[model samples]
Each structure stands twice: as C-alpha cells, then as structure tokens.
Target: MSNPKTKFSVLMSIYYKETPEFFNKAMQSIWDNQTLKPDEIILVKDGPLTAKLDEVISIWQEKIPNILKVIALKSNLGLGDALNIGLKECSFNLVARMDTDDISMPDRFKKQIEIFKEKDIDICSSWAREFDGDETNIVSYKKVPKFHKNIIKFSKSRNPLNHPATMYKKEVVKNAGGYKKMLWFEDYYLWARMIINGAKFYNIQEPLVDMRAGFSQLKRRKGLKYALYELRFQKELLEIGFINIFEFIRNVTIRFIVRILPKNMVKCIYKLLRK
Candidate 1:
C-alpha cells in the first residue's frame, strides 16, 4: 500500500499544437486512472489552447475543482519555461512530470511514492514504454540504470532519466537551477546539473507510463539543426566540467552521425537498440 501522507503533485504543460484527444486521455490517466491520485495537479497552459483542448480541460476542471490548478500564459513559453512556472504552484515537495500526450499506468504514482518512502533518493523515474498510435502497440521501452552510480556514469553519454515519467523533489530541482531552455536537451541538461550537485537518483525497473512516439519524434531528432543542437549541448557539458574532453568528442561524434543519418536508418537503429 502507498502512504497517504506522502502527497505529490502532477506538473504538466500543454501547448496549442497538442491533440485534444490525446490531452483528454492524458488527463484521464492522471486523475481517473491513477491508483493514488495527486494531491494537486498544476496544469500549465504554455499558451492559449484551441477550443477543443480548452473543452477537455474545462471538463476536468469542473470534475476535480480545486485539485486542478490551471496557470495560463499570455504567449507560448515552451516546455522548460512553462514547467518552471508550474513548479512554483505545486503544493507538495514531490512533483511528477507528465507529458500531454502520454498515458500514466494506474499504479505509476503509487509505486513511485512507495519508493520515495523507502529510499533516500532525490529523484526517481521509471522505465517508459513507447507506443505509436495506442497503448496496445508498444514500440520500445526507454530504460535507465537503477542505481545512483550507474545513473551518474550514464549521464555522461545519454539522458539518465525518463523526464515524462520522473518524480523529483521540488527543492532539489529548484536548487539545481530547475529546467533551462536547451532546445531538445533541456531534460538532459537538468540531469547533468543535478548529478554535479550530488543529487541522489533511482529508477524503477518496469515501465510506469506509456509514451506516444513515432516517426515524427524521430524526424525531430534528425536534420542539420538537431545535429547542431547536439553539438552545442555537448559543448555545454564540457564547459560545465560534467564531461571531460575525450568524452565530449566521443559523445558529439557518435550523436552527430546518428543525427545526420537517414530517418529510415535511424528508425532501424532505434528498434535494434531498444528492448
């Protein structure tokens, strides 16, 4: 059983481009489907949402009342900034990050809360299963190391945590500078800082959420622009002393090639690599 006293908040940001149907499903998972519901849900409107999106949100708001806190932005602030704003409104120390298009398993929050109760970690995230069009069609699993040492080492090369499935201590993240605008590498950069700051980490061995992914996600990872972003992000890692010169070169070289490869090749590589 989960501890009732260990209250947590679900922090989510939705922008105009997200599908209304997806957003509705996400809300159902966060509230209706959870075994252990959040004490509060901070939903950040990155910008003005479409009428359809607003309709879904409105229905949730009416259903949950005070538990659903909506923060509206005058214009789009992007995920990092939008989340930073939402963090300020969270009433609990533990905050779970949820993507607008993802589905949280019924036991996701319950299991995470149990881990927090038993462990001394500052952050905890579970493996996520990626599904293309629906939850039944799982494409891959995004798994991370289960302990702090392995997580630290893994951070030197790739992201050490699944951002959307993460539950982190609010003060620890804020002290580590919260989230920054690093294009596609925002979560990765934040993990680097947290690791450098000596924050403890842990990962559940099984998938706790279903992430929506497909070729569109892969497309965003390709192109010269994405390759440049990878280079810049890697350079930032070196500058911050999180990774040494050799690691920087190796990381950038491999990522650069992968980013510039044909989309079809990348897809094959992803399938081959992920379990």
Candidate 2:
C-alpha cells in the first residue's frame, strides 16, 4: 500500500539523443512499480526535444497522470545543473533519483521507503548490477549494512550508495545545499556533503537496478581523466578524515583488480553471491 504521508517525487534528468529505448525502459520500470508510485514524476529534458523524444514524453504525460511537470531546457546545461533544476521543482517530501539508461526493479521504492520508516534514515539506497551491454556480463557490489558508520567507511573509496538507486529526504538535501556543479562526479560530492551534515544513510541489500555501463560519452573519455578524478576524490576524502591510510590502500587495490578482471568472471561471481 502506498503511504500517503510519505509522498515521493521521482526526478529523472534525461538527454535521449543516443538511447531512447533505454530511457523508455527506465521510465516503464518506474511506471510499472505499483507499490510506490511517485506523486510527481519530474522529467527534466536537458536539451531541445527531438521528434522521437517528444513523442515518447507526450505519450507518457498522457498515460501517467502522476507526471506533474516536464521541464524542457532551451539550452543544454550539464547533468549537475539539470538535476539541480529538477530538485528545485520537486513538490514531495521524499525525492528519488533515476537515470535515463537504467532498469529499476519494481519493488525498489517500496523497499526503500520501508527502510526509511523503520530506521529513520535520511538517505536510502540499494545495491545494483552493472551490465556491460550484455546481460551476461552483469556484476554487483557487496551488500553493505544499513548504518551511518559502516557507510562512511566506503565513502573515501567509491560511492557507497549507487547514485541512481538512492532516495533521500527532500529537506535533508536542501539542508546539505543540494548538488554542486562539479566538472564530474557530482553525485559522489553530494553524498560526502550529506554525510558531513549528519544525515543518516542506509543501503538495502538488493539489486534494485541494472545499470548499463561503457556506452556513455563519459566512458568514452580518455582513461587519464577518470584517474585524475579518482585522485582528486581520494585527496578530498583523506583531508576530511573519512579514510585512513590502510583503508585507502585497500580500496585502491580492489579497484585495480576489478579493472583487470574479465567482465564475465566478475558478473558470474556477483550473481552467485547476490542470489
């Protein structure tokens, strides 16, 4: 049953120039999830709408009466700015994040809200599978416990909560100053800021999303750029005292191993354990 007191606003910032099919899949997943239908579905089109995308959005707008607003940007602002605009327009107390090229499980929002109510958590997220074009090459992360201290441990290395799978209290986000216009990795920065502001986080141990990887422009960029971002991220975390030297070394080593491992092997291991 939907909780009337806990209305959720789902914010999807999309640029469907390349993969309209994936965007449709993502939106359908949310629409099909009956237990936790969003009070308002805020789709922020980050650039001028193409005919194909316009048709899709129009159909959805008519089919889903809950879709409260569609903000079509006249000019392209990057993802961070687009998300900020979406956040500003949300009317519900709980805000959920969605990505254009991912598939969310039907029970995602229901499970997240249940956790939020039970634990009084400010932010809730879940584990997700990374599918590299092929579903056969799906990989998942270890299930972290739902505690602020445990979550803070992984903050220095990589994002503890999958960005697309996260749901947060709207007021908590505003209090933390919302998303910043970082060059990249704005989600990670936002998580760090939220944690610093004494917001509690929880990760439901389930594969709530299937995120397609290695297809975006961000993935096509030179490997050196990603390395530089990680270096900067690590430095910032270290300065903030979230990670010690030993944890830092361990985290870096694990990431290195994942990079070299065969995609299929990683997928198999993850699926086996996740089940």
Candidate 3:
C-alpha cells in the first residue's frame, strides 16, 4: 500500500569543514529547484560550525523555518552517529538521505517518490554524475543496478547503492540498527546489513544527483590507516555472513592496495575503470 501524496523527510548532516558556497548550492537545489518539495527536513549540526555556515542556515530558517527541524550535537560525531540521531527525529516513513555538497536535480524527489508509490522497494537509489572543477566538465557517471537481485549480487563485491542519492523506508533503516560508527564504511556497512536481513533494494536508471568530485575526494581514500579501517569493515561483514573468510581476505587484500596507492594513481584508475 502506497500513498500517492506521501510526504517524505530529508535527512542531512553538516560539519564545520564544508564550504558555505557548496552548502548553499545544495540547499538551493533541494528547496528551490526540486519539483516536489520535501514535507520536513531533519538536519543535524554535527558540531560547531563557522559563522558563514550559520548565516546560510539562518537564511534558510527565515525562508521556511517551520518545515525544518534542526538538531544540534554537542560534539562532532561522524556521519553514522549523526545520522542515527537524525533518524529518530524524522517524522516520515520515507526518508531521503542528502549530503551537504551534492546537488539533486529538479525532478529527483518527484521521480523517486513515484517509485516508492508504485513499487515495494525498501531502499531506492539512483545514478549520479560525477563532476570536478565545474559541473560543465562532468567526468563520469555512476550507474547502478535497476533490480533487487542484481543489487544483492553486486553488493558482494562493492556497495551497490549510491548513498547520497538514496531514499529509504525509515523502518528498514531502524530495523537494520540504524547507521553505525564504521569509520569510512558506515553507509556500506549499513547497506550490507540491510541486504542480509532481506531488504529489497532498487536503483533508478537515470542520474538524479550531481556528485561533487575532485582532488579532496581522492585525498581521503589514501593512507595506511584508511586501509586498516577498510580491513576492519570486511572482517565485520564476514562475521555477519555477508562474505566468507576467503572473500573477506580477498577484499582486504584489494582494499589495502587501493587505499595505500597514491591519490593520482587511484584517480587515474577510477576515471579509467569506473563507468
């Protein structure tokens, strides 16, 4: 049973490090450009933010403060914990996850919502256009599976869902134990858990989000410490039966090499191999 007029909530978290310009753009894309506006928006302030960030928030508050629910965390919890907190505050059965920097297209919500109304999907994500320097010079498009069976199979090797472009049933997430503190693998870990628990997943065939990409994105993926975190993620999946010990070791081996490689090399491989 689906409501054609179902109103959904947008869940987002903002930290001090994000630039105000990109933040404003993301906000404008959601509130000003979307074909169907969100009913409620649950935003978590991860920690103290700059004056510029505050000013941008204030502007949004002045525009539609009633539609916004702001939750402030005393300390900087990472995305997982912050989102877990925000989830409890969201008042909709359908919740759309939004990143602070990515821009959703005008019809993004309209199209996603229609799918929810027409299908039995527990989580629905979409393709994304990755851009760097400028949106005009779009580098690559991230295309994902359009069916549940394909998504589950793909999840064995890598995350099948596009995180920021996803709209999920809130109960599905809560039942999956909400998001956890998995360092860099928070979203992937949650998706993996949901899949093992028999959550139905889908992905739209068209790009609904413009993912911000560039040097900073590449920089975050390197280092020995990151490799260690990735290995920990794989081991947890093995313990949960999402992967076997053999698959776990193989994942760790590949992750260690990829995570420790130079940023330029990683970027080259991504651009060359990533479709």
Highest lDDT, which number? 1
For candidate 1, the clash count comes to 0
Model 1 TM-score relative to the real fold: 0.97
Name the candidate, 1 or 2, with the larger lDDT value: 1
Residue by residue across 1-275, what tens digits does model 1's lDDT show? 84357889999999999999999899999889899999999999999989999998999999999899999999998999999999999999999999999999999999999999999999999899989886798889998999999989888898989999999999999999999999988899999999889999999999999999865677777878989989999999999999999999999898899988887899888987677
Per-residue lDDT for 1-275 in model 3, tens only? 84558889999999999989998899888989998999998989999999999899888888889887889899999999999999999999999999999899999999999898889889999999888867666888888889999998788878888899999999999899889989988999999989888899989999999989755576877899888888888989999999988888888888789888877788887886557
lDDT of 3 at 152: 82
Task: State the TM-score for model 2.
Answer: 0.82
TM-score of each: 0.97, 0.82, 0.96
How much is 190 displaced in model 2, in angstroms?
0.8
lDDT of 2: 0.76
**Sort by TM-score, top down from the best:** 1, 3, 2
Candidate 2 local lDDT, 1-275, one digit each (tens): 85556778999887756477777788888886546778888999998867887777787888886574899888889888999899999998889999988878888888888887889789998888777776457644435555778888767666778889999998898898888766666888888888888999888877787777633322342355554566566666667766777876776666545444565665554466444
TM-score: model 3 vs. ground truth = 0.96
Candidate 2, pairs of clashing residues = none
